[model samples]
Target: MVDTTLEGLSAVGDTTTGFDHPGLLYHDRDDYLGGARAFARAAVAAGGPVLVAVPGSNLAALRDALSDLGDAVHYADMAVAGRNPGRIIPGVLLAFAAAHPGRRVSIIGEPVWPGRTAMEYPACGQHEALINAVFAGRDAAILCPYDAALLDQDRIDDVWRTHPWMIGADGRRPSPWFAGAFAAADRFNRPLPPVPSAAATLPYVVIAELSRVRAFTAGQARSAGLTVDQTEDLIVAVNELAENTIRHTPAGGTVSFWTEPGHLVCQVDDAGHLVNPLAGRIPPAVTSEGGRGLLLVNQLCDLVRIHTRPTGTTIRMHMTLTP
Candidate 1:
């Protein structure tokens, strides 16, 4: 088994060829700005491409702080670009890295923030852990920032487990509690909470019933106050997942929908087992024949969570009622 406890490590700036995943535990705005600016500057000095993909407000602050770099540093609003944590790896990080081949890449990716909802936190944690696996041999460093003052203790602890290195006010060190990439991802691949008792559910037996699935999703989205565009997006996402069930599993599956405080949730359960953990996160090539369904769902919905085992697999898609 891979070593869960990462012992004997140096500071964050040790300069390694392999992937470096560091967690920046910043206590306040000033601390956040300082750490972020320093990382960006170091990347520029190293002559590699730099990408700062953080929440909108943080993106604005980094832009102002790094004004002298001009277009040398790329900026993306994580709130919009990475709204669905599942998309951050393929859509944002890897996409930027792919743009500049043969060059080491530096990225400041802040996926977790105070405003992240409980329903979204699991996916965020999983995303952070999976980054280590996705970029294992690549020459890249990703600095993930967590708000120490605003976020809860559980979230802070998760940061320690997901990242191989932790950076605090004092300095950086290897995380004693760091779990290997797959272990951490499996830890976050927990069974989703039960949907409300009132959630609408429908069963599908074959491809012929896909239209019914879309109609059901549309009805639930509209009833939950989703706008026309939002409803259409949810319908498409649900249809894609349901079709996967029909195409892959012999037993078919069930579709369910419900509403939380600020979001509408849709779920599909099938007997198929998804062996590939990175199934939907990586973008396929242009000439590829298949494998774009789940990626499309991740882009269409606000959040996507998957729980798969030998017995079955359950995929849930969340869409905010307001946006």
Candidate 2:
């Protein structure tokens, strides 16, 4: 009998016939490395390999910890590989499937700085959607520590539905770039272009020219074959950031989006110094009716990179689109 009432809990029937229930394990208590080792052993014992994804710093640690498992463990560095989660996660799954044929593989997400809620970064809507699409039909498990404050019940459900198992390392603190780096590693051989730059001649502030920028973004998405939903999400992120340029800059800014193999890169350039240090990040308090624009942008974009100078501020965001 299965415990139907437990939150995020379900029993997976025998795999010999077919996986009865999608296996999901939600344990929020354990040491990350220790849990990883145990999981690796189990996967190997079950005639499958363990794929460990982590930052470069943790590579040595993971290798040493899982040394006992010998050929059962495969290590991949998400950071050194360039941190593209879309490619890495699915690539890892495909590799495992090829090697084991019928057996399921386990994924160990040993994120650095795992348990701190303050480290949680907002994932762009497109990026999250892309991840879901990649893991669409695979039997795998992702283990990491839980941040109760950073994750809500609904978000947990989303994770469970996407990942068969979620083990929470109680005291561990995982890094924010966990999934991003993994994706990058999977496509390491490809040359990732530097984020696009605009010419100095590009007008800093010209509200009349907004259409040109928006058109360029849409064109880029279309050329890249991004889904309508992903393109729209990216567009929303662009609009919010562009509006910020108008509101904050004395001179307007340039907004641009470019296509990568599996990403939509966007930038808003403004000739204004954000006098407010927390300009694009901090949302307005509930009692306050205004100031939520940039906050909303932050929530919508996967990653936000800010560059400010005497001339202006340039905000860069990345949204992953299905390939």
lDDT of 2: 0.49
TM-score of each: 0.91, 0.41
Worst 10 residues of 2 by lDDT: 116-125
Tell me the tens digit of each residue's lDDT in model 1 across 1-323.
11111231233343346688899888877778777767777777778778999997888899999999878899999999989999999999999999999999989999999998887899999899999999998999999989999999999999999999988865787999887888888887889888778888999989999999988888898889999999998888888888889999999999998877788888999999998888888888899988988889988998999998999999999898774
Best model per lDDT: 1
lDDT at 63, model 1:
91
lDDT of 2 by residue, 139-254 (tens): 65544333333456654443433333333422222233335422422222221234456412233355666666666667766766778876776677676667667766776776
293 Cα displacement, candidate 1 (Å)? 1.9
Give the alpha-carbon lDDT of every model: 0.86, 0.49
Model 1: residue 260 alpha-carbon error in angstroms: 2.3
